[model samples]
Target: MTARLANKRSFPHPPHAPPADSPALSIFSPIIQVFSRELQRQPDFDLLLAELCLDHVWTEPSKRDSKGEVANKMFLSHNVLSQDFANFFIGSLGQLRSIRVVHTVSNITTSGTMFTLSCRDAAPIRDGDLTVVLGLDNSISFYSGHVKCAVAVIAR
Candidate 1:
């Protein structure tokens, strides 16, 4: 079977380019390092675990058989992701206290959770303050205030 493009977008091939004087190599690198250390010590850290959960997906659409019925299979390894989306998620992990994902897939349920995370940073443009909507078909879920409270409690 051949794949069809339902839509398309035209953006810079590489969304972000590393500069000659990148922050990673700048004098402020120490400050950034302290900030990351502080973030890790704040609460139930485990950045690695959070990262895995943030990227994990239970079921993905397997290749269709001759009959064209999409076969559902457990995602064995990592999912193929877009650079833009990956950057958004990584940035969110640093800014937000916690992110929660809940996926419910059963025989009779086909509806997923819908939620948004609106960032109101100092400069919307440079900080990339935007609303992200995720999860479509009983797959991904996000809860903001609840996650904050949970993280707060864990930190305490």
Candidate 2:
């Protein structure tokens, strides 16, 4: 029975290639294939791809250039810091076009190093988040008395 079963069934051969005129064989297919191959060549492609995918989605009017074609824009904001807790801000322009850094001030006085950050735009921080890291060289200190500080955001 085992010998008869082995001879009874045969698997079909795999297709060598997709048909030339198949709708799936459009120019985008080859471009996607090449893009995927190129992405595979990069060591950190997966991480980069994930970050790109996670960026924000926004709708804004398109400005026409000399070419005069409609374009879409995307905006995103994020923050990052070193293990030592040095502050920094990462903001994304529409379509990842540019990045703006928010200036951070570290004041070292008799009390301690006080860190302050100011945003240029007067608009409320819609998608703002902060991250803090404490390190040996840059540790947070508590003062005996309450300290008051005021922050103002001036728009351009």
Candidate 3:
């Protein structure tokens, strides 16, 4: 009852890097550099969270919940200016349970740019709330639901 092995040569590696002058390569280099520099300057979680609270784009019915209430659900969008900030925050914090890109359609068209971050395991206490931080020039905004609670902030 011995099992036979499949051929190993069928999975050869792709060709070497593209020539230096390739337009795609040239365009990609600067993008990569900017990404690397941004990563290097990633901010701490508290700072990021604070920024989110200030810049959040509230959906229609911009209402506030009573303090200490926990939001079981909420949604945030990349178009809110907070998405990029959250990405950098979570990426730098290295504590995200999962990050998913969701597609949403507006009244007249269908498109997508929103990122849904579920931090259940990573930030269990704040799991159900939508929190974000936006970084625009030198300004910062922070926004979160009443349910959002972070151990990092509690300790302070």
Candidate 4:
């Protein structure tokens, strides 16, 4: 039997990236990309990402500087044993701006540590949907509970 050749199929090319003059994508691109990969890998990624995003979107506007910018502050206290660990973790908060250690009560524990941090924003948190904020994940948690505790305290 004789065989016939078929023409190659063509698909349309995606439009070019937005022009530089265009307004930048609100600060949620990285979060979207990372969460997208996570979602592809695991079914529960959305739940995890959603929970984490909640903390970022929750903030108090009462604590702001004269310029009306959020001036987040932290209260870190630790015993001799936890001093180094605490400092190291705090240092991990890279380029920490609008945040400071306003109150510190040292020697609060014989061999433990504590921190009370509050994070505010220039604008009030949105009622629904992801509110994009930059530099949120510059710091990472070493221990299991560190991130959750920090987020909870900051939101409060």
**What does candidate 4's lDDT look like per residue over 74-93, in tens digits?**
22232223332121112233
The 10-residue segment with the lowest total lDDT in model 3: 80-89
- What TM-score do all the candidates reach, one by one? 0.19, 0.21, 0.19, 0.17
Pairs that collide in candidate 4 are none
The worst-scoring run of ten residues by lDDT in candidate 4 lies at 122-131
Show where candidate 2 strays beyond 4 Å: 1-21, 47-122, 125-156
Each candidate: what lDDT?
Answer: 0.30, 0.33, 0.36, 0.31
The predicted structure with the larger lDDT, 2 or 4, is 2
Winner on lDDT (2 vs 3): 3
Candidate 2 per-residue lDDT over residues 47-123, each given as its tens digit: 43432231322222345234433223222223333112222222221111222323335421122342333322111
RMSD of 3: 20.5
Which has the higher lDDT value, candidate number 1 or candidate number 2?
2
Candidate 3 lDDT over 6-80, as tens digits, reads 343443532466666678699799998988777778754242343223344222232532332333333332323
> Best candidate per lDDT, number?
3
Which lDDT tens digits does candidate 1 get at residues 1-156? 223322223433333654546765586778989989888788766556632333433232346224433222111111122111111221322221112233345222223332224332111121222222232232222232222211111111
Better TM-score candidate (2, 4): 2
